[model samples]
Target: MTKHMTRKQLNSRVVDEIDRNLRQAFDDMAQQPVPDRFTDLLAQLKAAEDKKNSGGQQDA
Candidate 1:
């Protein structure tokens, strides 16, 4: 005899598979440190913010 799955059961299985894959990907990424490129980008952003603030001060 064959068994049939309900719609809820099929939906739950798909959700579980997606959750498992996301967890695995997160775990893999957790092993690495932030890259230098990202760090440099952050530094550049900070410099731009500082320049903006200084310019605003001069304008006031």
Candidate 2:
């Protein structure tokens, strides 16, 4: 005999499916490579921070 799912059980299943899909999408996106411009900008920012930390002179 087949068992019937209650309304709450159906809702829970739907929510679980949505959560799984969203997590998978995020995981896929996280696997992508960082864009060149973004990496370049981050490197520039780090260099500036390092210069400042080393007491490098600021631009006039």
TM-scores of the candidates are 0.55, 0.87
Worst 10 residues of 1 by lDDT: 51-60
The best candidate by TM-score is 2
Measured over all alpha carbons after superposition, the RMSD of each candidate to the real structure, in angstroms, is: 4.3, 1.9
- Best-fitting candidate, measured by lDDT? 2
Please write out the lDDT profile of model 1 over residues 1-60, one tens digit for every residue.
449888998999999999999999999999989999999999988987898888744442
What does candidate 2's lDDT look like per residue over 1-60, in tens digits? 459998999999999999999999999999999999999999999999999999995995
Overall lDDT per candidate, in order of appearance: 0.89, 0.96
Superposing every Cα of model 2 onto the true structure, what RMSD results? Answer: 1.9
What is candidate 1's TM-score against the reference? Answer: 0.55
